[model samples]
Structures are given as structure tokens and as C-alpha cells.
Target: MRIRIVLTFILLATGLLGCTEQRATVAVPQTAQASFSWFEYQGSDPVFAEPLAPDQYQNPVVAGFFPDPSITRRGDDYYMAVSSFTYTPGVPILHSRDLVNWQLIGHALTRESQLDVSGARGSRGIFAPTLRYHDGVFYMITTLIDNGGNFFVTATDPAGPWSDPVWLPELDGIDPDIFFDDDGRVYIAHNGPPPGEPLYEGHRAIWLWEFDPKLQKVKASSGRIIVNGGVDLSKQPIWIEAPHLYKINDWYYLLCAEGGTADEHSEVVFRTRSLDQAFEPYEGNPILTQRDLDPSRPDPITTAGHADIVQTPDGEWWAIFLATRAYDQRFYNTGREAFLLPVSWQDDWPTILPAGETVTYRPVRPAGLDNHPVLEPLTGNFTWRDEFNQPALNFHWSLLRDFARQWLKIANDKLQVQPQAGRLSSLEPVSFIGRRQQHMHYRASTALTLSASGLSAGITALQSEAYHYYLGVRRSSNGTTIFLEQADGEGVDIIASEQLSVSGDTEIGLAIEGDKDKVRFFYQLDGETWLPLGGSFDGKLLSTQVAGGFVGTMLGLHSRLEKQDI
Candidate 1:
């Protein structure tokens, strides 16, 4: 909600005007301002529209770069949140009545004061978040990697204006999950370094601390290490993170994501009769994993772990975790997605999926959920369009960081973007708003009236500061120049460009298409036919394999201003 403040300032200061075909004749600063008549973006992928039986639900209930999912329920209403990293309004909060049908309600962190991702890299700010509800308050506890340490925010209503961070300086670590005990006590569990130093490469520990819900702080001297180096340090389990503590059947169970976040990621379980006692690793330690499955399997869902289990009103147990849908070999542009599965108990140990079992595409619906299909599917192939008609931008749309300064606004169904000096190569926030590239074979396009000034306003498929593609139209006395620039290790290189003697009012249609490992850029002056701007470029660089981040590709509307104004 605070984004509106930054946008409003930008709109007024930059001579905000109602966007129309005629408004393009009115010129602002040639170097640093541009507004859109209306921006339209849609995805065309064929994988999401399959026929679903009345009794089954899709595996990835929520798709895209939404990873490290944490969920809580109140009666029949369920609320979930996912990690957003440096993108702000960080921590997208979603609501689901039937657990299968979900809607993005709002964001947990919105204001600049609430979340300052100023100097953080593309995937370096926010880490895994664990959302919980206790005593009529929703708590989102997580770590800030490059910014601050562990902190949490609270809100009476999950969809709302959450309080600012209450920093947990003493409770250091990432992926912090808060547990409210049945006996009126509170605890926080997180993945941290092992006691007394480094044991192995991926050696990590799960630590617990006594938390005071009243004071809203961690109690000093109540810290303890619950699981050292995963289920067993001798085996040297790597990246034992994302710990969620739950009490069921009178036993405190500690569940965590084992191994690094790759093909080897898995969830393991440990339990103890009391919090003060040593935890006993489950006989079948890694209760859930796809690592042992054949890599060449068809339509595979790999890198599954970081799971959190919840119970329905009917006492049915279900789990939500993060996984990836990859093509070729571990090449996923859609990022880590949220997957759903059922929890089955074997000899009192909760298991999401058996060791050798492959995660299914369509799983049976939770025991008693009514058939409520989502209006827009997040899984598989789906198309999403935004005309900027809403009072605010959709929660799914993201800025590079907090919308803290003058950059953009939404007015009269148009997304008015004021071009900024920062380019996609700068670590700081740029004049950009993006949506997840949610499919292996997909296309996203937008229409914008070019300023013909010192700005190039068009579309971008961005992976990071240095790894992205920009296709924009710049208008000047020299006429309209449509160009495509690719950013990578060496630097920005113009892949292709074209010159045209065009007017400023022409609503230029720009689009980006990605097919697995490659991408293409296009632009249109007539708004119907797409003229190629650049040949196919390597889309693999957008994947985590080359970009090396915790996020996926984002197709965004970008307008970069000239460095030296003429």
C-alpha cells in the first residue's frame, strides 16, 4: 500500500497527465520521463489448461519464483506467504479458502521503512520466511541476508498493513519459524551455523530459542541447538535449513529441508518428547526427496524440499513446499515454485513423500476440500493480463526494491512510469516493474506510447543486474529507434536495432518470447504485427545455472533514462 505514496509523488512532480492517444504530443523532459497509455501483459503457455477431475488438485498450487512457502490456517480460511528476495513489497501474502484456490491478497512488507532493500543484490535481501498465526495475530518471521538480520512483522489481519520489523538481533540465522505451544509458550526455530565452528562444507544446524509473545522478543539465555548438521552430522547432511517446529501427538517434531537447494534437496524429520531433550532422528530420516529418482524421468519435478505441514479443520494433514519445474537439465526460468502434497504418518513420523517416490503432477485433493477451482491458475500453463485498471498494481507485480521514491503510478487504467537514471545493470532499484516468466515456452507483451525524448520505454526480461534483455523504443529529433540490448558478464551489448521515421503518439507494441533455452525480442508500430527486434539469444543465462540466484526470470515494463542529456 505504501508504494502508492512513492508513485503519487512521482506522478505529481513529473507532470502527471491522463494517458490517451493525444497526450503523447505533450512533451516532458526528453531525458527522464515517460508515461504509458496502458500496459497489457499476458502469458500463452499450453501446459496449465488440462482437464482436472473434481476430486484432484494440481501439484504446484502457486507457481513462479514463490519459494520457501509457509502456511497457517484459521477455521476454513488458509493464509500463505512466499519469499520475494530483493523485490519489494517483499513477502507476498496469499489467501485460500479451500487450500487449492488461492488469491494474492497483498504484501507483508511494503513501505521503505518496513523493508529497505537499497543496496541488496537481485537475490540477496530477503530469505526464507515462515508465516504463523497465534492469538489472533499473524507473524511473518524471516531473515534479511544483505540488509539486516532476522526480524518479524505482525498484523491483526493477514491481508493488511503489517507492523514494521521487530529485529531479533540475538536470534541470528535464516529461515526462522515461530511456534506457539499449547501450554502458552512460544519458540522460534531456524537454520544456523553448528556449535563451535565448521564441520563440513554444507554443515548447518537448527537452533531453537524461547520467544516472548507478550514482549515480542526472543528471551535471552533460552537458545539451544536441536539438530546439528541435519539428521546426522557423520553423514554430513548439507544445508539443513527451513526448520518448522510442530507439536502433534504430544511430541515436538522438527522438520527441515536437507541438502542444498538443487536436485538433491529433501525434507527430513526429527522428534523429541520434550523441548529440552535431545531430538531423535526418524528411522527413515529423509522422509521426502526426489534425488533418488531417475533424472531422465518425463515431466520431472525436482529440487523439492523446504516444506511446511498444516492440518485442516477435518484433521487431514497436508504439506506445502518449494520445488522447480525444469527443462533440459536443471534449467528452469520459472524459478522455485510452491508444490502441494499430503502428509502420511509412518510409525508416528510424518512424511510428505517416500524416499524413492516422484512428486506427482496432479494429486488427490485433501480429504474434505470442496471443489473450488482458482479463477486464474498459478500452475502449469496460464495467461495473466494487467491493464493497470485496479486501484493499485496487482500484488504479483514487483519492483526491483521498495517503491520508495518517485518512479511510477497507476491512473485511469494506465501505468504511468517516470524514467529513472538507473539502468538494469545498476544494483540499485531501477524504473521497472516485472512479473514472473511463468512458463518454459511463453510470451509477454505490452503497449506504450514512446516519449521520443531521452528515454527508451519498452519491455525487459530480466534475470539480474548484469543478466537481462531490454527491448525499447526511443524517440528524438532523429526519429524513432527500436533497439534490443543484452546485459551479461562483459557488459551491455546491442543485439539488434532498427530505425523508423515515426510519430510520438504511436503506441509501440513490444514483446519478449522465451522457448526453453532461448529468447527472442520483438516490437510493433501498428499494434498488430510483431516485427523482430533481435534474433534468438541465450535464455539459459536467465536460469539459476548461469545467473546464480534464488529467483527466476521477470518480464517487466522498463523505461531507462539517458545518462547524459543532450
Candidate 2:
């Protein structure tokens, strides 16, 4: 199984679609008597894979919304970063020592000027990134599809005040990687048009240019097409992207992802003795793949490509790549998650997950590596509770994108979201902060106080830009009420609701229970008593199978107003 916590988000304006929704009034106290502790759901089956034997561990070294991982080692310390898409903190930087454990360090792109993805669609902001350390400086080169095309940011420290992006308008495509040769020469490679197009279907090539660090641009006269149409000219592979250059011994090896980012995704390699000579394709192409595996294997992981290789201090090599864990056969809502696999090199060519073998949950730990501190569960199961008592939310929490303006704050032991006029499904940022759903069977709840009429705050199971379910409390001049709403292609539908006699300072509890098959919504006035608010809804509606995107489900607190605008 693949574990991912993702935040490729897109927001919409509230109430703009003019869909009629049901409303109800309820009575609740203004203050919560006690805070409820986060509890795991008790089910017949285990929520997580059993922990590995003391000597062994799990794949998905980093879980949740962490994908397209590019890793670099700096003196026994390993630093990795992943794609964040349209999320405000574009590239999430993580630090690890053992490769099995990782911690969030900081983002490489935090400023709107550095990387502005405001109003960009989900999964359209940032693509793959290549993180490398040369001398004392750290360099991250990536493509911001929504802003400028290709750019690189530099920081002396991995936990960084990353420099503003140095855009390379000369680099014509995405998935860019920088390679520094031993002879004091720097090169940049990317998936771009061959000198001319229109050769055949799926016609794409890997282009390279000599990069001058002092000038922060590509040397125009040094451009060359390295590999055209992938490994086999007769096969015609599509989307030969995500290029990485590695020089071993005397050969320069070119590694890239071919096919697409779907089930057919695979990694292919090529090598050459000289920089400008014709590169020879590996006789055994597609160094990594899962497309040929049996479809009926239980809890299969498909789309296993777009991989990056890293070498440890002990001479052990591992490949970090993106894959999906489908729930109930072909439905996966977790997006593409980072998976770890050991790499074995024989005669200068590397292979992943041996012939006739698929990705496994418990891979033997690399030899001679000391284990790092385990801060979170590797099985993607845990109890998380936030009372909003801190000055700022934890780094683990994420917002959809940088809002047009600030609309929320943390104060008075609660997260106060501005009452903007809109629905929870609005395109513009209303008021939302969320975390990814790491398990199929889990419980999520929140306690809140609503002070004004026409304001609502509660929990949501957000799948994408146009699909989600909301369990919220709406206040009106008459009384307060709790309601359950679902947003589908037909627009918003109020499935069920209940009225309560609530006034100022009243507190109410909302909860969501999700299983592999369906989800149930509930609310409570007394902390111990939960009243079901709606019938079980089809859980597959929120699955990527039905939602169709690169984002997983985000569960979080959201508030909307009926007559206010931000």
C-alpha cells in the first residue's frame, strides 16, 4: 500500500452556483465543557498493516501528500523534497538520516513572489523537482506550470530561506534536473521538443544544455537533443519526462519516466561515454515497472514510475518514486504517494523490485544504516487532535492555496475563520485548514462555537474542486441547526438536517466516520452523545476513481457565511 498526505487544492467562491440547500436550527451551549481526545475507530480488520519485524520496516518512508520525492545526501544527513502542486508551500522539504524515517523541515517556495499559485487548478502549480547539493549550497530546480516555466532556488541550509527563483526562460519544458560533471561543467536536462516536431505519435525527447551558474541561464549555443522517442524507436513510448543525469565510472546515465503517469508508467535508462555522443539504450529497458503484474493481487499498487535514485553513505542505493494504493480494487483517493524500493546494480545497470516481484510492504532495511527516530507511524495510522491552542497550526496542516487575502487566524484557543458569504464548496477561499485522510477507516470530529446568524462551521470530506461532503451547523435569527450536505456534479444537495434551540456562546460537536464502502455523518450537543445526522453515503464518490484528480481527500474545519464577502 502507498501512503500519501497531499494538498493539491483548488478553491471556489461560496454560494455562487445558486443551488438551493436545506437548513435547520438547533440549540447548543456557547462553551465546550471538555475537549475530546482523538480516538481510533474499532473495526473488524486492522486499520494499518502490522508493524514490521524489529529488523524490517515499511515502504512509503514519507506519507501523505508527499510525492515526486527527490533526495540528496549531505554528510550522513539526507534531505528530501516533494511536489506540492498548487498548495501555498510549493515544495515540501523533509530531512532524514536512516531513509526509513523523515521529518518536515521547511518549504523551498513560501513567498508569493517566489512561487505564486493563487487561483491555479489542482495539480497544476508545481511539477517534479530535483534537489541536489553542490559545494555548500543546496539547489532545487522545478517547473511551476502556472507561473513561469522553469526556475531554480538556492539555499545554503536545507531548512531554508530559499532564494527567489532564477527563471530559465531558455529551458523549454518541465521536469528539469541539473547535473554537475566532475570536469567542472554543469548541465541541465529536461523533456522538450526535439529540434523539430511532427516525427510521429508520442514524439518527445530529452534535451540538454550547458548551464552557466554565474549567469543563471542556459548557454544558448550548447543545446543538444540527447535521446529522442525513448529507448526503442519502433515502440514509440509517450511522455519521456522526469530526466535525471548520473555519471558512474566513465559513463553518463540518463534516467527518465516514460509512458504516462498512469498504469503504464515505467522508468527507462540510457548511457553514453561522451556528453554529445549517441546514448545507448539499456538492452533491458524499463528498469522499474508494475504494469505487467497481475491485476487481481490484493491491495495492488499501480502507476509505479517517476522514480529518483539515491545512494546512502554505506554504498547502498534506494529508489524513491510515486505509486497509488487502490482501495476496493481500482479506487484510490490518496493520490500518488512516495514508495521506497531497494536498487540492485549489476554491470552498471540498476534494477528495482526484481523480475516477477512486485512492490512489497516490508522490505528488508539496508545493511549498516542506523535507524532514525520514529516520530510518526509508517503504516499511515495515528490519532491526531488539534485544539487550536497554539499561535500557529502545525506544519503538518495545509491550506488550499495562498488566498487573495488573509481570512483566518488562530486566537483565543480556537481557529477563527472569517464569516465570508459563500458555501463550503465555493471557489474562493472561504475559511479552511485541513489534513489528508491517511486511512480508509477512521473517525474525524470537531467542536466549535458559532456567534452570528447565517454562519456555519464544521467538518468536510473534500475530494476535489467539485466533489465533497459537509456536516456543519448553520445559525439563523430563529434558532441554530445542524445539516449534512453533499456537493456533486448536480450542485449542492442537502441530504438531512435537524433543528436545535441554540443562542450565542453555544457549542456543538460534528463528526465524520469513513469506511471502505460508505461514510456516516453525526452531531452532538453533549460530548458523549452523538446523533446520526444523515444516511450512509456512497464512499466511492470521494474516491479518485470517481473524482478524477491528483489530490486525495482532505478532512478539516471550514466556515462559510450567507451574506458576507472577503
Candidate 3:
């Protein structure tokens, strides 16, 4: 085996193409190669995997980078949608009969006409979405920040050919939620600027508008500021956003997320008897927050807010909120995850969690629901393996801001991903596909066959363009070498590399493990023992706190041209 420095660039590998996908239009080197025989991801978090009573369930009903969750119910069936940011196939739609075991149905935004995030940053595309079902129609209202403003898509079925976006140019704000009153009234609520001069930085208000379902537009001259500066103005609340409205009995309830989406993040509520009346703040505001707890608490869950509440057919109320579980306090790489909590009603007021109370990691299952068969485990310690045998990609896989073209092919039960010039950091969408890093103590591995003239192709743990870790293998004229590459705000750097004695095309295995703050990278050849390619590195670099993005870490196969400049 000849030893040599490995200078290789990694590209983003995507999921297998559908049967009708056209040929890829992107140019690639003739010798480029990235084919995976199998990919597997497993998680073993004791806190989540602990034995639970049949009446109990995991807190994070939907895990990983799925954030700003909004749920809607259609009789006994429940459907959910979450923010996908810059990834194509934007809002993932999940379905559940019991609301505890959810299954991926499809995406709400699949076509370029529905979601165009081109030239947007990794964390800058799709914002909070409010999914609602009324009168046999499903509506998903959301904000597409940079390219477009607010919009709504409609579909008869949530697992959809969701209609092209009906852009809401008149609306101004994020997390646009639609509410239908029993009195044949339609309203829209969102987070945006106050009526006049701002009181302070992050001083925002909740605005309400009467929307016309028939005309598909906001009623002219019907917009008004409903809540200013959150629950209180003199108290000086910051970043009051993600407003969700509900009406229980005669009182109209308004829920909003406050205090910027960090440790200070929280959920608050207000109530009024009618829309014409002013909403009064709850006497005990900030129904949910984790900032007051000690930072030294073990396996702390922080940034708990952004809730959307729904009622079951049995008259039970449950709230689905976004929160972060950090191995170390305030630092989490898995991003904001969807948590489940029962909403307790107190004297005609709905409360999720009391102030200063820690969010529970495990909660009793919703009572009066039948024992729905487990389709698959969304929470707890579970292993998911994909053999590339299916004709179409699994809904779990994600594609970053790219059109659904033929960037990948599945033949002989192997996923073959062509190489691309653009690295993951480029403003242009790279040809990459990855799954959200769901667990802090999980391992992701894949087995791929590298060509004799091997191009760069391997595992990547990506948070954003500026912050990502790439474990790639390439074959130079000297020999084959595996390297661990990382990029931060500063730039990309090769941290570790090892030359292999393999002379020809070989099946190589790559793996990455994230244990709290520490992350390790590894690679192996011909089913041999996995050898460490890099030392245990700080995993916080891949977290939202460090990366400064709303997205979580993605762990899966990513590839790039072997000749691209660092």
C-alpha cells in the first residue's frame, strides 16, 4: 500500500429516484462513483428506551429535525406537518390513528411549483406551518421566507398531490395559522410587527385577518393587531411568534411562542369570549418553559415552546410542541424535536406545563384509545435499515433545495448517486440526501462500493453549510484513503486521513456516532472491524446553538466531486 495525502471533496447524496424521474441534468466527471449497498441507523438512549407501561409513551412523539410541529385531527385519524426549511419535499405529513404512533404519509410540498427555495440558505426556506382540516378539505398555511412570503396549499387527502401554492401576498408574518369558526367564519393569525413604533428589539405582535375560503384571499380592511408584545408589553417580552388560535366553549384561545427560540423560549396563552373582544393574558403566563431549571441538570431538555394544541374525539386535549434534548445543558445536535404533552384545563383555561416545572420525558399514553398496532417506532431505541429495494425513496429521506430529478438511481438493489461539483457549503443546491440525526447516542453506517478510480463519497453529519462533518473515502493514483473533513464558520479543513492497501474496487463501510458532546467517525473495508478515522470531537459544533441555525444535524450519505477546491 502506498501512502499519500487525500485531497477530495464530498457531495450530497440523495435518495433513489422515482420510476418516472428524468435523467439528471447536472454534469459530472466520467469516473465519479458513489454507490451504496445498504444504509442503517440505530439509536440507544436509555432515558428514552426505558421500559414503559402499556399506557405510557415517549415524550418526543416525532424525533429529529422535525420542528415547529402543527397537528390537526380528522375524526379518529390525526395528521401532522412540520417545518422542513430548505429541504425539498418541504412539509412532511404524518398520520396516526392513536396520535402516539405516527407514520410518514407523504410531503405537502413536493413540486418546485409548490416550494421553491433555490438560492436560500439551509435554514431559510419553509417556516412554521399550521395544518388544519375542515369540511373535507386539508389546508396547510405557512411562510416561505426569502423567495415567497406566506402561502397555503390545499388537498383533499393529506398524503397529497397538494395543490400549487396560493401565495398570500397580503399577509405579513411567519407561522401563519388558519382557524375556522363554527359560525361560518374564517380567520388567519400570525406573528409580525406591531401597529406602530417598536417598543424594543424583538417586539412583535400577533395579527388577525379574516380570510375568504371561497375567494382564497384575506378580506380587505379586516386585519388588526390582536396581541402586542406577547402576554404583556410593560413586562418586555421578546420574539412573540408562532400564534395558534382555538375556541373552546365560548372563549377564543390564542397560543403563541415567546422569547426567541432559545433557552428563553416559552409558550403563552390568552383568552377572549369573541374575536371582536380583546384577548386577555393568562394570569399565569408562559405555560411552558425550561430556562429557569438548573443548567447542570442531567440530560436537560431546553428550548421548549412553539406548541399547537388539538383535541381528540374522546374530548382529550394534547399539545405538540418543539423542544431540544441536550446531552450537555443548552447544547443539542439533534435540533428541535416534536414533543407530546397533555394540555390540562384549569378553570376554563388551557395549560400545557406550569411555569418552572420541567417538561416530562415520558408521559402516560392517551387513555380511551385502542391498542393500535405499531407500524414503526418513532421514538425510543430503534433501528431503521434501508436496502434500496423499493422503487421510490422512503419519505424519511430528505433532499436539500433541489428539484426531483434523476440525481440517483436504484439498480440491483443498490443506490447509485452521481457526483456533483458543488460542495455542501455552496449557495447552489448540492446533490445530497440525508436523514435527521434523531438521537444523541445513535450510530449511522452505510456500506458502499468505491470504484477503482474512487471519487469522494461517504457519510456526512451536516448541520448547515458553515458547519458539517464529512467522512469520505477516495482512491488516488497511490492508493485508497479515508478522511474525516469538517467545516465551520472559518472554512473546511481535513482533520484525519488514513491510507488503505486496497488496490481495486472494494466495498467500504463508514460509520459515525454522536454521544452527547462527543462525536466519533470511523471506516472499514471488506466487512472488517470498524477503525476510527478521527478522534472524538465535540459534537456541539453541529448543534443549533453553535451552528446558529434552526435545523438539526443530518446523518447519511453525502458525496461531491473529487476535484473541487476546498
Report the number of the highest-lDDT candidate. Answer: 3
Tell me, by TM-score, which candidate is best: 3
Q: What is the TM-score of each predicted model, taking all chains together?
A: 0.92, 0.89, 0.93
Per-residue lDDT of 336-446 in model 3, one digit per residue for the tens? 999999999888988898877888887888877785656666778899999999988888888888876576877789888877655666655476889888888999999
lDDT of 3: 0.84
Q: List the residue pairs that clash in candidate 1.
A: 30-454, 47-381, 48-381, 452-475
What is the lDDT ranking, best to worst?
Answer: 3, 1, 2
**Which pairs of residues collide in candidate 3?**
10-559, 10-560, 11-559, 11-560, 12-431, 12-432, 13-432, 13-433
* Model 3 stretches astray by more than 4 angstroms: 1-31, 452-454, 564-566
What 10-residue stretch in candidate 1 is worst by lDDT?
1-10
Score candidate 1 by TM-score against the native.
0.92
For candidate 1, lDDT tens digit of each residue in 1-566? 00001113233233221111121232447334566665444554445568778787877888788888999997788999999898988899988888877778889998887788875668878899999988888999999885689999999999889998999998777999999999999999988888987788988888999999779789989998988998878888899999999999999999999998988899989999999899999988687888888878876888999999999988989999999887785778889988899899877989888878888878888877776666666666666778788877777789996566467777777888887656776654478988887778888888888544767788899987657888878766666778787776445666777887667777888888888898988877786788887578899888887877799889888886642221
What shift in Å separates residue 75 of candidate 2 from its native position after superposition? Answer: 1.2
Candidate achieving higher lDDT, 2 or 3: 3
* Per-residue lDDT of model 2, residues 1-566, tens digit only: 11111222221332233333333323323332122222122222252457667777666666555777888889888888888777767788888888877878778987778987755656578889999999899999999985799999999998889999999999888899999999989999999985576377667889999999888889999988898878886787888989999888798988899998777888888999999798898888788888888878887878788888888878888888887777666676556778888888888888876655788767788777898875644345567667677886666666776634356666677676655444445445556667767666778888877766656777888876567887877666656777777876445677777888766666788888887668999887876899888678978878776767667777877776642210
CA RMSD for every model?
A: 7.1, 5.7, 5.3
